[model samples]
Target: MITLLRSRRSIRKFTGQKISKDIQDLLIEAMLRSQSSRNIRPWEFIIVDDKKKLEHLSKAKQHGSGLIKGAALAVVVIADTNKSDVWVEDASIASIQLQLMADSLGLGSCWVQIRNRMATDELSSDQFVKQALEVPDNYSVESVISIGYPAESPKPHSKENLQYDKVKYGSFSKPFYQD
Candidate 1:
């Protein structure tokens, strides 16, 4: 897992190759296995592969979501607000799990945040996405994960680039970087 974590990077550019059904099934399983507080499991997954819908979702946000249109698959992560107070955290876990699973499967993925963002000055990204996908009012869109065969290969983050100063011991003043 550490090796996977070390090599994983967000991939925005993808080739035209479509993901296989078996691989997609594996990715869905990874999302389903995500852990949630009290196991409320309030999150839901939307697997979108249609080119037209992918193009539509690419505009969910103003600038950061354009990569979706090029992806072979995009998974929308959403949660039922009434199911848990920590639905955001739960949904976030599933989102990352999906990305990690994609990486393990030799696929590339990028996360597009939607919550608390805008599609335009007049529209909330959540609202725009929901309207496009026809999601229920009870659910909230947290993110859209774009996945596909990578067209551009990015080098893994080096250990030296990690901000070790952010780590601390028992006290915030005690830097754990020394350890």
Candidate 2:
């Protein structure tokens, strides 16, 4: 399990293969099991399988061009803004769990952050996305996740690239456990 978790990497390229329904269900199950703040779990999921809509969403979202071309499925994870402030955090945790589960299931996935109106300087924006998906105004699209079989194997992360000693700590600078 640790090896699988450590080996999971963001895959940008994918073959034109379709994902199995069973695998999709497993991914959703993993997502459902994710921990939520106060167990509120204020999340709404939208699965985009339509080719035309995927293309449109790619244009709307900055990092979703790959989603249009490579993904077998694109999941729009929305959080209810009207709900608790922790809703966003809860939704985000669920998204991460889904991605990891997808990886374990021999699927590739990438996270595309959905910036709010304040970040983009367009107050009435995201209306286009909402209208396209037919999502209620109370919900805000938090992230887009693209999943598919990988076209190419991801490059392995180097041990030199990670500063595990600095991150692990017994007391700040002190190492938690000496290697």
Error of 2 at 136 (Å): 1.0
Worst 10 residues of 2 by lDDT: 117-126
TM-score of each: 0.98, 0.86
What is the Cα-based lDDT of residue 107 in candidate 1?
97
Error of 2 at 119 (Å): 11
Write candidate 2's Cα lDDT for 1-179 as tens digits. Answer: 88886687888787888888888889888988989988888887888877777766666544344455568888888888777688878889989999999988888888866645322235323565677799898988877788889887877686667776776565787886576
Model 1 alpha-carbon miss at residue 46, Å: 0.6
The candidate maximizing lDDT is 1
Best by TM-score: 1
Which segments of model 2 are wrong by more than 4 Å?
63-66, 117-126, 168-179
